[model samples]
Target chain A: MFTDCSSSTTSRLIHLYNRNGVFLPRPSVSQFSLRTTASTWRCTLSIRSSSSPSAIVIDGKAEAKKIRDDIKIEVSRMKESIGVVPAEDSSEEEVLKYVSGFNDDPSVHGVLVQLPLPSHMDEQNILNAVSIEKDVDGFHPLNIGRLAMRGREPLFVPCTPKGCIELLHRYNIEFKGKRAVVIGRSNIVGMPAALLLQKEDATVSIIHSRTMNPEELTRQADILISAVGKPNMVRGSWIKPGAVLIDVGIKPVEDPSAAGGERLVGDICYVEASKIASAITPVPGGVGPMTIAMLISNTLTSAKRIHNFQ
Target chain B: MFTDCSSSTTSRLIHLYNRNGVFLPRPSVSQFSLRTTASTWRCTLSIRSSSSPSAIVIDGKAEAKKIRDDIKIEVSRMKESIGVVPAEDSSEEEVLKYVSGFNDDPSVHGVLVQLPLPSHMDEQNILNAVSIEKDVDGFHPLNIGRLAMRGREPLFVPCTPKGCIELLHRYNIEFKGKRAVVIGRSNIVGMPAALLLQKEDATVSIIHSRTMNPEELTRQADILISAVGKPNMVRGSWIKPGAVLIDVGIKPVEDPSAAGGERLVGDICYVEASKIASAITPVPGGVGPMTIAMLISNTLTSAKRIHNFQ
Candidate 1:
């Protein structure tokens, strides 16, 4: 179970979960079939392996639902709906005005601006305009700066990266003293993920386009996270025996057998990695759902902090 | 040869410096004797080596002076004095008020609050109050956030980390694809230095107190930076032969023969590391001076940026 808890709370919960021996086993592939929807692409987890796969399949969809359920209980207990202000298709100035309005509104707890603004708009400027307190997306420079600093905590962490760590915590994965390698250095997923892992006491190495001998470094990782958005860039050979894998890359690839004639694939070649990795997150059902779960969690958190609610 | 230059400009300068074959040699211990004064501690560089030191001594003090000279020329050309407002021994609210005043002041280019504020003062809150445009100290979370993000530039890089990188640039040390290890995770130095090294395209690993086998990881570094302030903590066995070492740690230890009844030392054991490493920085004269130089450089850059002075 997951809560919109701080690091200390999360650590305590992790210990409680471990002491109770409540480790959730990899659900059978059949269990996932019932959960598939049009929004979530259909893919057979067992089919990814050429032979009987030894690795545990991390059911991120299930984990995300559990988190949402926990959040739902918390929200209902608060007995108040948190307001989120979203402005769409507006000029930069117009969006800034809307953000300003939300900043002053006592009822509005969070404000999020959609990314990849119009070519004429300055994205950074628009993002910077949001009040840091209402920056639930955690893209604000101040929040990120605090996240990067030791002995400091950001008001919010980027939802996607927070979700990735949440999955690890829920699964009782040990991060301390681990050799962790992050593939890609993107601001959204890779960079923040690396920072979060480092904060968790893992020795982290970040590999990007300029990195030499990436395979050599990847082979040393006890845990590996790939977020380069490249399909099948990481091969099974790159995996160290029994390494935990978190695949954040999701790309639609040609697949005639699929319902939509296309299917989602991750950075890791899942067919091969499942045999070697001790645990792995699948493409569509993994980090994708967790991102949404964390956004909702952040909004709830923002509301609580704003009202000074316990 | 050092300028208050952007990364691109520094890269170009490094290329030019490398092509000209003008790398400065380690100054004789006697040359340093004349430069020492009451403010600066007197320490012999070669004396750290029990035998003839094969490693090149990175003369950070000399390089810092060169940087200051460049800034001096730039300041004269600007023909304007950049006003810096410093607040001391103020309550949190008082410091915030001063910061707000400086933020509104047109002539003020920078606002710096000396660290380790009174116990009643919230340091992060005070630091965050500074305007991002005038945060020459780069302690502002916004600046740090921008620094951590890819394809984004911070208004200012933190002085100590910036100084560390500047020394590497001036000495024409290659960063791309190298395995860089940073010891410590302090906000002011270790964390930012690791981020800067990663930005330079070095596959970087950060080792902190919780690291299980720091020596094992340090041995893999082609470039190692030790910022943990424990004196002589990093031994020769921890260093990889031919690696470059940057010691940011400065701790005064007991030395009866020294002038003040004590002398400064770095995290690394200079006597042992000099034999194994290709180059190393001496504590008293290394990162300390470069920090001051970067502060002056940042101030000048802020002024130029505020005035649109090329």
Candidate 2:
């Protein structure tokens, strides 16, 4: 079927691996829209035919705001129809109790136990308590596992990584045959980001502290995503010219000029990288806003899945 | 602390990534009967300091036999003391009923539903029914998720990949700083195998059907693991001379002279690869035996975990 499609003008097959690792022909475009880029082109793994000479800065703040607005509308609609008032939360147990309630409630689309719970609380246990069906954050191990897999659809993707990918999608960054390097491997960002890149058909490599010649690896990447919270760890020399850089790292460094006595910085030397790279995200505006926006998106998606909404 | 161990004769720390991907110094050396060759020679990421002039065939058969004997003894003792009998099964519900029973049973430590269940049943759903603590196969999504992430430990590593790593361990093959390539990304073998390699500080790359110029990727590996079922797909030229190869793929190719009208083969061209490669696993005697051994080992570990065995 893919060969048949590949020959036609409707060549919409994105490369995908099956559960068996067999290269089967599955169409990229689908009715259910659960379709991922599924292709069986072993011999001819070509880059995207379309060319975008340059990348544009993705407006994560505006994009996130729109999603939040959409979710707000949905929440209001639920409130009017079902008398669903938002649950109150302050303490750990209270938060967990509410999450448990939402887990059972058909009206509740998503459950989020915001991080930095009381020091005494066990975060893993509490987070695990969220029903996987409503795990919009996609922090659950099963969800993470599904996300890491080639052919599996995670119920939800971690908002930060999802947002990172979403930004690329919105900006039309082609990763199909690119060499991508992720600086860190954090479950929240780096690891999931690597998985996301692989899903889009990029040859991905994950570099860590143990990695030797990290700059050499970074320089080889056409797309570089750095999530390590080390301010300016990635120098301009480490980046490949014309590479698409997505900096997820947000660090606080002492800054006398800033009113707060500290300023936010990223893993990559953004000032230098912006000059060197073709497209890059800033420390404050790039990924920060997208995280919340993705949360809203995931919540909306969960609601749709839970309620069987079109 | 690994730093303490690094100062002495004992320097074994497996390259590990955490759930958050924070590089945690987890000691891989265990008092357990089954211990992997976990080492901490970050400075000495060099290929095996001690040389095997020729590729040594890892005797997975003898190793498996030893493990099986130990498990058999443990099982016999379990049977005698607890009077635990094997559960009966046929239908999906019945099988699930037994699995749920094992989940609750104080005596039953591990649960394994042999593959290729009834056509009417859902395999993934039935497998999910098994308690993760007793999922000896390590096929649970949580386990797999943990395996994929850094800073998290899966209760059980999938057998074939574990065996592949164990062989390297037994042979003193060093992977740190080595570019390792995986030829496929199946859940059972390739994907987990790549993770295991990454855990051991190997710079890993996965080549799939969508991979363009796979030979280029394979040639870059100091360690290559091939799990694609296609027999003799990997040739001598694809190998890096002195590179270590683990052939996870076992295909039963048609052979008129063979007794069963078929002969077992691996993904790599053994005749060619053995000559070019430094170390390699043979088809029939390699990963196949280790898989069963790992199940027994997992069952024992589960029993220890369940019964509070010291």
Cα RMSD to the true fold for all candidates? 15.4, 18.1
- Give the alpha carbon lDDT tens digit for every residue of A1-310 in model 1: 3222111211111111121242221222322111111211212222264456788888889998998899878866776544322233567788778778779998875675544466878888877888776775887777788889877888789988898899989889999889899998888888999989998988888888777767788888998999876555677778999999999988665454567855677877676788889999988898999988887777677657655667
lDDT of 2 by residue, A211-288 (tens): 666776788788999887755567667888899999897756544446685566666665456656888887788899
> What TM-score does candidate 2 get on C-alpha atoms?
0.71
Name the candidate that leads on TM-score: 1
Kindly give the stretch of ten consecutive residues in candidate 1 chain B with the minimal lDDT sum.
B7-16
Q: What is the DockQ of candidate 2?
A: 0.33
User: Which candidate has the highest DockQ of all?
Assistant: 1
* Model 1 root-mean-square deviation: 15.4
* Native A-B contact fraction in model 2: 0.43
Q: After superposition, how far is residue B180 of candidate 2 from its true place, in Å?
A: 2.4
Interface alpha-carbon RMSD, every candidate: 1.0, 1.6
True contacts kept of each: 0.82, 0.43
Give the CA lDDT, 0 to 100, for residue A288 in model 1: 90
